[model samples]
Every structure is written in structure tokens, then in C-alpha cells.
Target chain A: MTSHIDTCGLSCPQPVLLFLTALRKTEAKEFDVLVDNEVSRENVTRAAENHGCHVTAHQEGNDVTRLHIAKN
Target chain B: MKSLRNIFVSPAGIILTGAIIGLLAILLQHYGNPGNMGICVVCFNRDIAGGIGLHRASVVQYLRPEIMGMLLGAFVAALFFGDFRARGGSSPITRFLLGVIASIGALVFLGCPWRAILRLAGGDGNALFGFAGIFVGVGIGTLFFRQGFSLGRNTTQHRASGFVMPLIMLALVLLYLLYPPIAGQEKNGVLFYSLKGPGAAHAPFLLSIGIGLLVGFLAQRSRFCTMGAIRDVILFRHWHLALGLAAMLLAALVANVALGSFKPGFEGQPIAHTQSLWNFLGMVTAGLAFALAGGCPGRQIFMAGEGDNDAAVFILGLIVGAALSHNFDMASSPAGIAANGAVAAIGGLVICLLIGITNIRRGA
Candidate 1:
């Protein structure tokens, strides 16, 4: 099962930190992180990319963005 | 998907988000949200603390529904979206201590990050020092961040861990409902009600709740954060969230001009002091703590709603910190910074620097 991390209402480093924590905990090689706003979206994606994960993003409605990242 | 993400990520969308907050804050003030305050996280926390007898300051006690409403609004949103997680345990005690000292710093300055912005919007030039202090403080934190300062990693656990703070907010709302201001009475039904001062003036309860809910929802949706706004600008030349604050400034300025609340002067500003040194130092300390803590007070409250127990602990620490300041006269007054307040501010700086050094890793 994919670990879904919701980081809405959180800011840049926070979303990134939470996402990293989830990445560390989950055995699943695949992950999905939900965030709101561009800053968070960018920061989370950057962190995942730094971890050598491949990331694809999807935007929901007007505000939320979901990023799917998988280990190469 | 890239095109979709670009929509709200554009300059206009973030600006609109900031403008909405600014306009709403000014309007809330016009309708009664504390003079020149609009929405201040620290002050609201202090007021709530006093209402619950954390401090017996008779003139500044009121159980503000906006705080309660904000938490609940975020809680509802988190629940609906299936993001409610109760993960914590990342040096909770350390975070609690940071919140304590940060509250002391904010109390000395008489405002939090949002209040600093609100004060500037209302044309109080004293806020210039506050802004400067925050920049310096956060810059210091940024230095530590560059050097690998970290509080440690948060670990996930039980799902119920996240709901603690929201439950506390619910209890507070119940207390607010239980106590109706007795017109001339200060204490009513186990709650303290201020008859004068900033706490005495407020928008109607339901109205405040409605506005708080709207802000909570929008802020949650956009991840709007004051500290993050400035931090991003400092760390990266990114101006996305910065635009939100700029929009708030412009919109609040316009609203102040239209409402005749714009009094551009450094002297006799509402609930502010002319002691420039303390103002700068105060926010510097608070700002550093805020940066170390990784979010502003508003962000903490919203995080609590999402069931982050760490965030809730920070708020609890705020309550304890406020009480300590008031009980020991460690909080500054309009007259000037109290002796202990100065001591506390300096003490916080030393401790925060120490924390920064200790958390720095060799490779990190």
C-alpha cells in the first residue's frame, strides 16, 4: 500500500520534514504526499528529488497538490 | 497537471490570497478585533490563558472564540481530507521550552508575527523595529539551519495523538459558552472576562467565529504562514509566499486609509511602546524561537487541529510562558520593558543560540 502523507496547513520545511519522516518509516518504496500551495509543493518535491526518488505531481481543485514519488 | 499547478502558483493567486487575509483582518478590526490588532496569535493565546485563570490580570481576560474556531476549522478540514495524523516525539520537551521562551519574547514586544504586520498595516512605525528584529532573529536561525541545526526527526504513532489539541480547543469553546460576560462583572461562571483593555473589545462571538473559520479554511488550503513567508524569501529568492504578505500590507493599508485608522507615527501607537531597543530585542528573541520551532503561532494552532501533538505542546508552552510572564512581571508593559522581561529576553537568546549550536551536526 502507498503511504499517503497529508501536509496541508503546514509550511515549507514542515511539509518537507514530515514527508521525510514518513519516507523513513514506510516500507513501501512508493509514496504520495499531499500539500497545499506552491511553496510546499516545490519544497516537498525538492526534498524527495534530493532523496533520489522520482516524483510526479498532481494538483487538486484550486489549492491542493499531490506528489507521487517512487524509488528508481 | 503542470498547467493546473501553475494556476494558483502564479503571482496573482498568492497575491489574492494575501489580499483576502489583509482585507478580512482590517474588517475584523473595524467590526471589533482589538485596535490595530486584527488577528494576533500571541495576544489571542494570552487572552485565552487569562480567561482560564492562567493569569488573573483582570483587564485582559477573554476566551476568544476565534482561536477555538480556527482549531476546529482546521480539524474539520484535516478530517475531511484524511490527513489527520498524531505523529510527534521529536524532542517534545525542547519544543515546549522553545514555545515558553518565544511567548516571553512576544509578550515583551506586545505582539506576534501577525501583530507586527497588523501594526504596520495600521500605520504604527514602531513595527519597523519589530520587523527588523524578526529578520535578524530568523536570519540567525537560518545560519543555524545552514550549519545543520535540527530539533530531530518526528516519528509517527497512534492516530489519536493528533486530536489532543483540538479536544482542548473544544473544552475551551465549551468554557466560553458557559461564561457570559456579566455586563459589569469581571469574573463570571469560572471564567475571567475583561471589562476594559484589549480583551474588552471584540467582534460579536458568532461573527468572530465565522471569520476565524473562513481564515482557517483558506489558510489550510493555501498553507499560508507568516514566518514561512519571510523564511522562504531569505532562504531562496522565492517571492511566492512573500507576495501574500505584501498583498496583506497593501490591502490593510488601503483599509486603514478608508476606515480613518491610519495614524503614521512612532509615538502613542495603540498598545505599543516607544522603547525601541526592547521592541527590537523582543521580536529578535521571539523570531529566532519561531524559526527554530519551524512555524508561527498560527501554524502551530492549525497543526494541532491536524493532530500534531508537538504543535499542541507548543501552545501549552505558550500558555505556561504567558502565565510566567504575567505572574512574575516578566512581560513588558506599555510603560517600558520590565527588568525581568529584559532578563528573560536575553536569557532566551542565549538559550536559543545554545540550542542552535547543540543541534548542529558535523555532516548535516
Candidate 2:
């Protein structure tokens, strides 16, 4: 199963912190995360990668970026 | 053009922004903007409060052009870069209270985080305690982050809402031009000007505003923030923001050395005090407030400029808090923290802790 989290309009550390919490609590090994800013995008990716998660990201529009994370 | 724009947000770009700000801040001082204080958001805000009759601190009253210029610069950058958005509605009152606490704490320590770094660069040992307090405060805030604490997310708003702060900045500039200060006069029309003291000692208006605008523009692009530097390191072990800090310190230190203004000691550092405990406690309050509010005062200003109404509210809180500090004797001086300063600092810490704990979302 894949868990989805929307962090659009949220600032740094919040998005990453949310990602980490979801990663820990959920039984799922994959996440589709939405972020609206560059800092949040970079941070959520870094946090996932640091936790040994494989990640792929793509810009969805002018402002929003979506990331796919899978636990290794 | 895209690649060049990308450089402004790159690691080297952030470092370059910091270096330029650090160097220019020193130049601001060399041109008469208080020693060891090139760019202090809290102090400048306090002075602006006084300038606008929000406070009556005679020695610290001026309509600082630097403050106005920064907002304008950021506004220009945001507009040009297509980063401007009219967004806000995340716990604005709470953010305002946080700004008040942040400003009071900074005033208690006699400097904001930027000034603390500049003080260190100018060889003031007193800043060591301030930095330590900030680390501890941010560390504590990080613990709350681990527990899923957030102030909620800002929502999009009407475009007019985004222009308010920049318009205010432009109005202030107009006020300055219309009511230019008169020598030996404290009041020029409705505006206040310092006849003497730190507020009176400023670099040329154009110079101060020019440096401020440049910094504001670059900081908007780089997202340079002092509190964010420490918070990023503590939360994710990320060193991206820390590089900006290191560059600022290094650049400022070298500039001070070349200018022969490097004076190392806990005592007699210009516009500073030697009260170690209060200094630590003051910044402890400030750092936590900044973390809770999600940016340092400088970043808050830039954010406000870029159409963040929440940030604008927070900036208003800072101005009001500055007024309260001076009026109620909660601000510090070169002699030491005022009688109520320590109490205010403790109160600020308690408020921050309350705000931090109460805002947490369990089972997020």
C-alpha cells in the first residue's frame, strides 16, 4: 500500500518531520508526498533518502512538486 | 538566464549572499551605524518604533532607511522572479505573539541573531553566550518538531493582501523624504529623529538603503536566515544554511581585521553588556521564538516583503514589542539588562514553551 501526505503551503522541517512520522507509523513502504516550495521539496527528499528510502520527484505544476518514496 | 537565476539559490549563491551581507554590514558600521552592528533587525525595528512614536527612547530613535529598503528590495525580487503570492492565514495572532516574544528577547540581549554574529566577528566575547543560548533554544524547539508540532499551513489569499507590507515600506520611505531630519531637532513634522546616540549615528541614507536593498533581494532568492541555519542543522543535520552563517562570520571577521575594529573582550564591547546569564536567557527566548515562528527576524521581513501576510503580522508584533520593551524598561543597554529585562526574558521562554507544547498535533 502507498500512503499519501500533502504538505503544500507548509514550511521546512514540518514537511520533513511529517514524512518521518508517517514513515514510522504507517505499515506501508511507499509514500506520495506533495510539497509547494523548493525548500520543502529538498528537505522531504533528503529525509527520505537518509532513511534509506528510494525517492523520485517531479514537478506537477508551476508551484507544486510531488515525490515518490519507497523503503529500501 | 535560468542558470544564472539558479545560482542565486545554489549553495555557492547562499554563501555569496552571506559574504556580501557581512561585508556590507561592516561597511555600514564604518560609515557610522553603531559598532558591531551592521544589520540588526530587532534593533532597527526598535529604533523604527521609536521613530514612529511607538517608543520614546531618545537615543534609539530613527526612521532607519535600511529597514524600508530591505522590504522594497524583497518586493522587487519577488515580483521579478514570479515568486510573489498573496498567502496567509496560519495562526496569525499566535505568530504575532511569537514576534513580540522574539523582539523582547533580542532586546534583552541587546542584539538579534545577526547582531550576535556581527558582535562575534568584531571580537566581542559576549556573543559566545548568546550563540550558546540560541543553540539550546533551537535544540529544544527541534524536540517539539519531532513530536509533530506545527503552526498549521498558510492558505492563499487575495493579491491585495500581499501588497500591504510593501506598501507600508514605500510609505515609510516617503515619510522620510518629506520629513527629512533637522539638525538639533528630534521632531521633524510627525516623524522622530535622534539628535545624538546610536540612533543618530547612521551611515548616509543612500548607502544604508542601497546595502539593505541588495541584501533583501539576495536573501529573498537565497532564503538566507540566521535561525534557520541552526534549526536546519539541529533538525536534519543539513549544513546548507550553516554555510551562509559560516560565510557571514568569516567575511565579517576579515573585514573587522582589515579595518582595525577587532576588539576582543567580554567588557566594553560597544553597545553590549557583560551579564552572561541574562544574555543566555535572552537569546534562549529569542531563538525559540524564531524557531516557532519559522524564521529569524531578517527572514521574516523578507517573507513579509514577498507577500506573506502571516509574516507581516509577525513584523507588526515585533514593532509593538519593541515599543513595549522601551516603554516598560524591558530592554537592555550597554550597562546591562534593565530591571525587568530578565523577568521578561523568562516570561518569553515560558510563553514559547507554552506555544510550542500547545500547538502539537498528536497522532499526526
Candidate 3:
């Protein structure tokens, strides 16, 4: 099952850190993160890629972005 | 609604916002702010520190309204936009120490990242060295980031916790009004004032705060950050933030020319020094510290405004660091770098590198 982490309304480094925290705590290979701003989206993507994960992101609503991060 | 948000948050939107801020900065200078220093976070923080008697640098003492305005502006924007969430606990001590080091580095160079760009825009040749130093410093930080440097995680807190920094800003505003600067007076029972020098020079209080609030509101909305601009470009090849930075530079340069304040040279440029080597090393320390801390000084204030306690601690560190800089003679002057400023700059760089190395989450 894919883990879901909602990080909407949080700022940068927070979103990125949440993603990292989720990565650390889980043995699961996939995570779905919801971010609200472009800075958070880009930072989370960079962080996921840095940790050897593939990130596929898509726009959700007007201000929300959802990213599917899978471990490589 | 979507289109309106886009107009405020899109790439073009950010560029326009940057241009506006740049032009306003030069305008602030043209009015009465120190030359080429319309809005320097570090310098202003230093002055604020002195104003509060954290240091005894009489010539640089004043309760700067711009700092309070930025924080209050960001606070209001965060609340209106529903982004204020109280969170911290991610190595607060480490972050605070990094803030100190960052302020020291900035002082040695005599400007933060924004001021360095503004200096260049105003045609100060010495800023070139500072600019090059920031690039190299951020480059080093990128290496740590690639190696998994992390400051850990921050959990959610009580909503009231988020209001602390904003409340402090409001308190400062109250203090400024309660003890307004009296002419020819250095101190008025409480709070210090500079009778002369950069601290004494300022645009009208209302005008300064107004521009500051507007900049903060737009910056919060756009997530405008000087350190992030270079970091994104270096690490991810992203140009979004870089566009904003370039726009600020271009706009500031044009404004300087139009205002007839554009004087390009290495010597006698306002409150800047001619020590090229120290200037480079100074920003190298600042850039590294800023990169490791996750934001520049301005960004930290904005984050604090939005309820990040860790960023708030960093801002406090900057306040204390400014005190230490002047007390220990580690800050530079137009005359040149202090005797111990260069040593402290090197020490700051080493300390930041150590923090970067120690904070890496191995195998995670």
C-alpha cells in the first residue's frame, strides 16, 4: 500500500523534512505527498530524487500539487 | 481565483514582484536610507541590536521599523492565506549557532545577500568579490545537501506558539511608538538612537515601514529568497528563483541610473570597504551558513513571521550575533575590516562546514 502524507500549508524544509521523516520510518517503497506551493513541490522533488526516489507530480487543485514518490 | 493566484505566484509574477522590490529599495535610498543600503537585513538587525542596548555602537543604533514591518507583513499574509502553522524542534541550538555565524560573515562583508545584489546594482565594484564568494559558498552547501545533510523534522505545535514571533514584532512596533527618536538625542530613557552615521540616516518612518510591509506581503506570497535562488540553480538547474533575482538586479540598476545614484568604483562607495579578499571570504562564510540553515536572513524573518519557531530562533541568533560582532570588533566599516573580523570569518566558515558534516543522516 502507498503511504499518504498531506503537507499542504506547510513551508519549505518542513514539507521536505516530512517527506524525509516518512521515508525514514517506513519500509514501504512508495509515498504520495500533497504540497500546496511551488517551493514545497520543487524542494520535495529534489529531496526525493536525491534519496534515489522517482517523483511524478501533478496539479491537484488550483494551489495544491500531488507527488507520487517511489523508491528506486 | 486560480488566475489571480497565478498572477501572484507564477514565474512572471515573481519577476514583477522582484522588480518592484528592487525599485522600491533604490527609492528608499534616494529618499534618505544610507547609499546602496536601502534594505540590508544584517545591517538593520545590527542596528536594531544596538537600539535595544545589545551593543554599544552608538552610531548604528535605532529600532528599525522595516524589520518589524517585514515580520508583521508576513504574519498577516500567512494568516490571510492560511499558512501559519506553529512548528519547530529541528535542532534549534544548531540553527541558532548557524544564524550567529551567518550574521558574522555578513558583517565582515558588510552586507547580506540582498545587499550584495543591491551594491552591485548601485555600481559598487567591491560587491563583485562578495557575489563570487556567495556562489562558491552555496556550491559547497550543495555538496552537503547531496550527501544527505538534514536538520531533522519539526512537528506541529499549538496555534498560539506560531503567534510568538509576530507578537514580538508588534511589541517592537509599540516600543518604537512609545519612545520615538528625539532630535539630537542618543537615548530617550530606553532604546538607543544614532545621532549620526548610517543609523541616523533613514527615510521617513512611515515610508520605510510601508515599503517593508509591501515587500514582505509580496515575498511571502511569492516565496522570494536570495539564498534559495542560487541554491536551486546550483542543485536542480532550476531558473524560477533566478529570474526573480535577475529582475531585482535589473530593476535596481535602472532605478539607480534614473535617480543619478549609479557610481561605479572600488573606493569611497558609501559604507563599504576596499578589502576585496575579506569581502569574498566573508560572504563565503555567510553563504555556507545560510545554505545550511535553509534560508537567508530575510527568508528567516519571513519564516518566523509565518510561525516557524526554528526560524525565529535563528533570527534571535542574528540579533545576538550582531551584538557580539560590534562588541568584539568583528564587523567591518567603510574604513576597512576590523582586526579580528577576518579571523572570525574563517572560523565561521569552518564551523558551518563542521555543522554540515555532522548533520548528515547517514544511510537514510
Candidate 4:
């Protein structure tokens, strides 16, 4: 039910980009993305919805966060 | 429920707040923005570049802390709010190239999207033509996007990749603080600041930086982008982006009126020219390049602050292009476009179109 993408060290367009690619590869009902920054979180979240996915996000530490995106 | 909460509560709030902040920027500039400009992403960047000794356009050189503050403020906000992430490697070189071209286009036209609006608000009839050109350019880019045009996807990289831009901005701020511009000196520090001219004109450092930070924080939250607004409407008939753009124009108009900075004719506009065709062509070139590159100059700067190395490269490209513009006589003056400006604009359009067409997958 869950899939993961490690985007810890990517930049603006790429993190969102990799998330999109990961979305294409997974049919998991829920997806969790591990990112190292807030901008990527926003970008990924936006990209997810643009492709019809819903996202929920939570911060874990100074340099890490988890984004939960569900395929709608 | 959380997604909607974040969307409606955060991003929407950010958009509205950002518009208000933009209004404040106009007001601040009207009262005194160090010069005639209230907010100019490109010109300010050029000033920062000049302060660092990148080029010598004496009348328009200063180490603008607002530029540094934009990146740093965004950095702090992202860090504070748990948003700072550093990831890159998606067509960085291409992004840098696009940035350079975009800057050249902007300089040729003599301003970025924000300046275009400011010019219009100040009663510069020339900006009307420039806005029209921007639409045409964006329309072409939309055609390309529809054709499946893409610069290529980026892959994940190291955290250090993301920190590069912020560090550079920090260094610029340090230089500005340590080596304040001296009157009648060729070498002030790494760069030169004009004792007078447009370079000398600037809002107070702290005030400018404060405004920059406020704008950065709000814009980061809002996802407000000028190009995105036009692109969204063209692609999806969405008005969310359009609303923000309208808000900016409206805010500037009202603020300019209140400040008595609203001039009503094309003649004698500040830092602008009246060559209608070039104005249109210049922005057309700028608009296409911005669309292809993926954001407006301001948006790109905010993105760079949030660890977008590609966007950082684009920002650098703009800085370099600004230097190149003055060095090579490619930039426009209030008098008009330089001799080769039109040719360069046409060349840019051709190159962009070529890239757009070649990269598109025919049946994707």
C-alpha cells in the first residue's frame, strides 16, 4: 500500500521530477517521499496533485521531512 | 482534509499576503527606493553584480543587500518552517543557458515582468507593447509545451549542491557590509558602487532587505509566479495564477497613485524607452525564454534560495548576461535598443523555438 522515493539531495525541478517518475512506477495506494527540504516538499506536493494525487506532509527533523501522497 | 487545509490555509494565504507585501514594496519605493525603481529583480541583481565588480556600468552599480536578503530570507524561512531541501542535477547547464538568454532578453527590453508592470503603472506607454510581446512569446512556449517539449528530467544529487547559492548570497552580503562603497574610487572592493546615478539610487539597505525577505517568505508560500499565471490560463483556463498577477498590477497601480509616482505617458519614463517594436520583441524573447526555463526571474530566485541548483544557475546566468549586456552594447537604454538588439532578439527566438520543437515527442 506504500511506496517510497528518496529525494534527499536533489534540487528544485528535480525533486518534483523524480517524484513524478516514482509515481509512474508505483501503483501503491499511498506514497511517502523522503525529502531534505521544504521547497521540494511544496513542489512534489504540487506535482502530485497536478497528476491527480493527494498529499499530506509532516516534518521529522531539521533536515528531513516525510510527504504522504495518495493516488486518487 | 490536511491537504486542503494546507492548500487553502497556507498557499492561498501566502498568495494574498504576497500581493499585499508587493503593494508595500511599491509604497516603499514611491516614498524612496534609492532610485526611481520600487522593485526590479533584474536591475537589482545587476547592481549586486556591479557591487561585486562583475561589470562597470557606473551609473547603475551597487551591492544591493535586498538581492542577498531575498535568498537569505527565503533560506531562513525555509529552515524555520522546515522547508529547506537541497536537490539538483536536472539540466543545470541548460537552465544556466536559458537564464543567460532570458536575462539578455530582459535587458534588451530593459526590465523583467515586475518592471514591465511598474513601467505601465508609471504611465510608460511602452510597457503596453512589452506586455503584448510577452503574451505572444508565452503563447509560443505553450505550443511547445503542448508538443511535449521538455528540457529533460533532473536526478537527485548531494545536499552541498543546494547550499551553493545561499553561500554565494551570504558572501555578497558580507562583501557589501565589509567594503561599503567609497566615493570617487574605481575599486571599492570586489565590485564598484556608483556614487551617483541609478546605481546610487536605492532604498535603505535594511528596509530593502526587509521588504525582500517579506516578499520571499510570502512568495515561497504562495507559489506566485507571473509566467505560471499566463501559462496556467493558456493551458488549463485556470485563473488562480491570473488573480495573483492582477493583484500585483492593481496593487502597484493603487500604490503609485497614492505615492504620486504615477506618470501617464511613454515619454520621459524612468529607465525605459519608447521603441514599441523592440519593447514587444524584447519581452517576446524574454517571455519565451522564461517559459522554457520554467519560471519568472523572481520565481527562479526564490527557487534558488530553496535549494534549486538549476535555478541558481539560471540566476547566475542572468547576472552574467547582465554583465555581458553592458559590456557588449546589447542592452537597451532609454534612447532605444542597441544596434544589434533586434537581431539578437530574433536569434533568441529561433534558438528557443528550435529547442522546443526538437525536444518534443511527436506522439507522447
Candidate 5:
């Protein structure tokens, strides 16, 4: 199963915290994290990696980033 | 098997790190983190010291769980990714002294590097002086680096050294949780609270700590550092970190406008003084010490989480220095620079210069 976290309209650290919170509750092995800014992308990617996930793919849109993180 | 830094190992990674923090700082202010101060390392440290009874600065006392969160967040991230390593032994005393000098300098200016940038984005013109001072201070540190100024080598230590700081962070968190802010009062158990003034203003406790943890986790992985940004530019002509700082500044500016918090002026700024000279000198002193110490206060906390006991000692010095500043009336207020802040800034400059002069090698 995959989990999705939408962090649009939020600020830095918030997006990161939300991502971490999602990681804590999910039993899934994959996460799709969406953020609207550069900082959040960096943070989500980092947060995923910190929790033993690997950034498998990332997509960039006009103002949003969708990250695919999978457990190692 | 893994490390978090890999995710944010590129230029884009670092820039995003800065941008996110900048945006959040403004948003946090929009909610309630103080006017133009979202994540001031110096001020937060002072507040922590006040909360712990290090000094009796009546108005500014609270056990900011945000700071505690940063340490713990970094610790958790490092541990999860197997990057946590206990190390120390690089002129520990010298680093501590540098932290004290840096805190004093920041007190004179009433902001750290993060707050200085935020102040400008919020339309405080006086921050221009601070920016100037920061550059000049980094410039001096660069000269020393060119001369082979090194803080000695770090040696691996017992794992317990690393856990000590994390445990302290955990203990602080427990303290904050146990002693909720007293109803309509500033005293909560062993912890102190602020009923009024800038100290009284804050984001919700959970929000602040949650943000702090996120920042800590991300910063640890990205190796986000303000001092290193300028230092890299001066020494290597590298702009990766600089770009991050720029992005952060731009993001904050945009966020401030969106939130209707951008007020342009040199006077009547909240918790700020109009003494341009002091602002410049204050940053100069603080910046130099940060460079000499190899990181800013924010970076220090991150380093401390990674098992740098020396960095932890430096943080301790900062807390004590905050106490000393408040106790001695050396911190600035909206009214003006503190009574002896001028002399203290000058003294900090002297100390930093001496450290730079003596530590540098003729040839590496």
C-alpha cells in the first residue's frame, strides 16, 4: 500500500513535520508527498531518507513537487 | 546502510532547505513567533536561559520547546540514518568562549543571522547594517582561513558523549510538558513563563516544537548552515549555500507581503533599535565568532545533536552568555542598545581577532 500526504498551502517545517507524522502512522512501504515549495521538497526527501526511505522519483510542476519515497 | 544527507546533497537541495525555513519563519510570525523574529538562535537561547533560571530577565522567560525539538529532531534523524557519531576534542574551551562572544555580539544587535535576514525581509532597514557587518565579519574569518586557521582536530568519543546531549534535550522536553504555563502567570514549576512582552508572544507550544523538530530533522540531513553559506562563498567562490540563503530571503519577503506583515522603516520597529553602528558592529563580532567556531548558533545546535560535545559546550556557553547579557543589562531593547553593549561588542571583536590571529597556521 502507498500513503499520500498533501502539504500544499503550508509552510516549511510544517510540511516536514506532516511528512514525518505520516511516516510514523503508515504501514505502507511507499509515500507520495506533495509540497508547493522548494524547501518542502528538500525536507520531505530528507525526512524520507532519515526514516530509511529512498527517494525513488520526484516530479516538478509549475509550483508543486511530488515526491515518491520507498522504503529501503 | 543510509544517510539523510544524500537526499539534499545537491545545490537545489540546500536552496530548498533555506527557502522552506524562510517561508516558515514568516508564517510562524504570522501565527505568533514574535514580530520579525521567527527562529532567532540568540534570542531563543536567551529565553531558554531565562526559563531555566540562569538569569532573572523577568519579561523573557520560557522553556521554548522549539529549541529542544531541534536537538531531538536532529538526534532522531542522525540516529535513524546511522550518522550519529560521538566526537570532541577540538579546543573545547576555545569554542565555549567563542559561543559566549557570539551570544554577546548577537545580544548587541538583538538578533542572530536568521533573525537579521528575517528583520530585513519584514522591512526593517536597520538590518542593512547587520548584513554589512555579517559580510565584513566573514571577510575577516576568511583571511584567517587563508592563513590556515584551524580549530584543531576532532576525535571520536564514547557513544555516551552523544547520548548526553539528546538526553538533556529529552529532559527539557519532559520538563516543559510537566510544567505547563501557569494560568495567567509566568511561573509554571521549575520552568518560567512570560506573561507579557515579546516573551509572552509565541506560537502554540505544540506548533513551535513540531516545527522545531522538522527543521532539526531537515537541517541535519541537508547540512543547512548560515555561517557556512557565507564562508563557502568567501573561501571557495561557491554559491550553493548562498543560493539557499537568497531563496530563503526571497521566500520570506514574499510570505511577509502575503501576510501583510511587511513594514518598511528604520524607526519604531518592534524589538529593534535604530543604532546602525551598533547593528553593524554587533554582527561583525558575532559573525566573526561564528566563522571562527565553524558554524552559527543554529548550526551549533545541529552539530551538538550529531554528538559534537564541543558544540554542546558552546551551546551551554551561549545559554550562560544569554544569562550574563540579561543580568548585566547588555542586551538591546526597542528603546536602544544595552548600557554596555558597545563596550561588549568591541570586546567581542578583540577576542575573535585574537583567536583568529593565534590559531591560524603560517602554512598548512
Candidate 6:
């Protein structure tokens, strides 16, 4: 199963909080996170790794980025 | 919505709005608030602290409805705009400790980031040193941020947890309204009003409250923060936040001129000190703490209102820190820092540096 988290238009801790919420709801092997900036994507990806996940990132535009994290 | 968005959505727009807010504060001061201080988050909070019997600074005690109103106003606006959501459990303790340190640093210099600007507008030359200190502090914090330093992560909790800070603000408003201080007995009620000094001077209750609400609402929407402005410039070389900050300074400068309040000197400034070294050190500590904590005092208040419980805790820590500053004689005066303030300031910087360096991953 795959779960998705959207952290667009949020700032600082909000994106982190939203990612945490989505992570708690997922028991899936894969997670898709959408963020609107590089900083948020980096933070999210770092957080995922801290929680024992592997991340692959893709940038769509100046303000859009996606991260796919695989859970062990 | 369009007009409001125009005033607050862009970086320049938000800075202009912040400047207007600063100017309004000046006009408000001209009409009533003492010492040309129209809006001061730390001084007002200290006054509020006195009003609630948290301290006994007679000349600085007031049941400032504006402070309470800022939070409540923001709370209402956030709810109406679909922005309210309570969450916390992040390194709440750490954030709170940072708040305490931030407030102590501000009091040691006798003002928060906003008051530092307002003091300068009023011709307090001392603020120039404070401004420099803030830059140095932000520079240090930026280094830590670049190294991947974070206080910790926040976890979601029950919605009621978010309302605690707003509810406390509501309670303050109620205290102000019901326990109207008796004439000549300003300290008799559950709320106190200043009889003299900066605490006595204030914009009309309703006017101050209204402005507080407006600023709170707009700031929440735009994510405006003075520290963030400086930090963005130092860290990512971003100008979005810097534009807002520059706007605030320019607007305030213009407003002071129009109001005949611009003095352009370091001496005879209200609620300010002339010890150049401490002014620089004081703001450096505050700036660094704000950088680590991630917002200015005003921004922290607005964040607290928007259901960020960790922010609220930080604010509470500030209040307590103010009380402690006074009780321990660590706060500064117009004359300057107390006898031992210099030593404390240096100690603070060293401690902050230690925290910054140690918290980063060794290689990262």
C-alpha cells in the first residue's frame, strides 16, 4: 500500500507535523510526499530517513517537489 | 480578501503592512502611550505580567488588553479563515527554554526586536548598536541552521491542546474587562493599570485591541517574522523576508518623521540604555535565540494563537523569564545593564555558541 502526504503552502514545523501525521497513518511499503519547496522536501526526506525509510526525490518546478520514501 | 491579500501576501506587501502597523503604533503613542513607544511586545508583556501580579514593577504594571486581544483576535481570524489547528509535543521544553533565554536577552537590552526599532525611531542612538548585535546573532544562528541543527520535531496531539494558549488570552481579556482598576488604586483589581511611566501610556483599549487583532490576522496569513527576514537573507540569500523587514524599517522611519517623533540620537531614548557593548550583546543573544527558536516575539505570539502549543510554551517561558529578570536584577535600565549584566551577556553568547555547535551532526 502507498500513502500520500501533502505539505504545500505550509511553513517550518507545519510541514514536519503533517508529514509525521501521514507517517503515523501509514503501514505501507511506500509513501509519497508533495511539498512546494526545496527546504520542506529536504526536511521531509531527512525525517523519513530518520524514521528508517529510503527516499527518492523529484523536482517538478521552482515551487513543487515530490519525495517517494520506501519503508522497510 | 483581495485587498487584504494585496496588503499581506507578497514579501514587500507584508513589510509595508508591518510598517503601517509600526506607524500606527507611533501615532497611538503620540496620542497616549508614553515615551513614544506605540507598540512594544516585551514591555507590554512585562506590563501585562505586572497587571496579573506576576511582578511588582509599579511603573510598568498594566492590564494591557491589547496583548490579550492580539491572541484572541488571531485565534478568531485563524478559525474564520480555516487556519486553526492545535498541535504540539515537539521539543516543547526546549522551545520553552529558548523562550526564556530570548526574553531574558531582550530585557537585558530592555526591548524586543520590535521595540529596538521603535526606540531607534524615537532617536535612541543606542538601538544602532542593538541592530548590529541582532545581525551578528542571526549570523551565528544561520551557521547552525546550515549545519542541519533543529531543536526537535513536534508531534500532533489533541485539538484542545491547541486552545490552551488562546483560552489563556481570553481569560486575560476577561480579567481586564471585569476588574477595572479603581482610579488612584491602579493595582487593586485582578488587573492593574499603570499610573505613570511607559506602562501608563497606551493607545485606547479598543483601538489597541483592534490593531493587535488586525496585525495578528495579517501576520498569520503572510507568515511575517522579523527574525525570519534576517535569517533568510543570511542562510539562503533570500530577499522575500528581507523585503518585508526593510519595509518595516522604512515605514517606521517615515511614520516617525510624519509624527514629528524621529529624534536621531542615542541619548534620551525611552526605555533604552546607552551601554553600546551590552546593547550589541543583548540583541545578539536575542537574535540568536530567535533564530534558533524560529521567529520574533510577535511572530511567536501569533503562532501560539494559531494552535502551535510549542510556540505558546515558548511565550510562557518569555513571561516567566521577564519575571525572573526583574526579580534577580538582571534586566537593564535606561542607564544600562545592571552591575553584572555584562558578564551575563558574555556568558549567554558562549552558551548559545555551545548549543549551536554541539547540536549539529559532527560531519553534517
Most accurate candidate by lDDT: 2
| Candidate 4 structure lDDT | 0.74
TM-score of each: 0.85, 0.95, 0.89, 0.83, 0.82, 0.83
Report clash pairs, candidate 3: none
Backbone-clash count (model 1): 2
Model 2 misplacement above 4 A: A23-29, A45-62, A70-72
Tens digits of per-residue lDDT for model 4, B277-328:
8899888988998988878888888888877777888899889878877777
lDDT of 6 at B143: 77
Worst 10-residue lDDT window for candidate 3 chain A reads A9-18
Docking model 2 quality class: medium
Error of 2 at B18 (Å): 1.1
Best by TM-score: 2
lDDT of each: 0.80, 0.90, 0.87, 0.74, 0.82, 0.74
Error (Å) of candidate 3 at residue B166 is 0.8
Choose the strongest candidate by DockQ: 2
Candidate 2's TM-score: 0.95
Worst 10 residues of 4 chain B by lDDT: B1-10
Q: Taking the tens digit of each residue's C-alpha lDDT, what string does model 5 give over B212-291? A: 89889878877788887887677655565687788778999999898888999999987899999999999999999888
lDDT of 4 by residue, A1-72 (tens): 888777665433345545665677657788888877555676677677778988887887766789999988
Better of 1 and 2 by DockQ: 2
Better of 4 and 5 by DockQ: 4
Candidate 1 local lDDT, A5-49, one digit each (tens):
876654346566566766877688888888764556777776687
DockQ-sorted candidate list, best first = 2, 3, 4, 1, 6, 5
Candidate 4 TM-score, true structure as reference: 0.83
What DockQ does predicted model 5 obtain? 0.02
User: What is candidate 2's lDDT per residue for B38-68, written digit by digit as tens?
Assistant: 8899999999999999999999999888988
- The candidate, 1 or 2, that scores higher on TM-score is 2
Q: What is the C-alpha RMSD, rounded to one decimal, of candidate 2? A: 1.8
lDDT of 6 by residue, B272-304 (tens): 778888889988998898887878888888878
Total backbone clashes of candidate 2, pairs 3 or more residues apart or in separate chains = 0
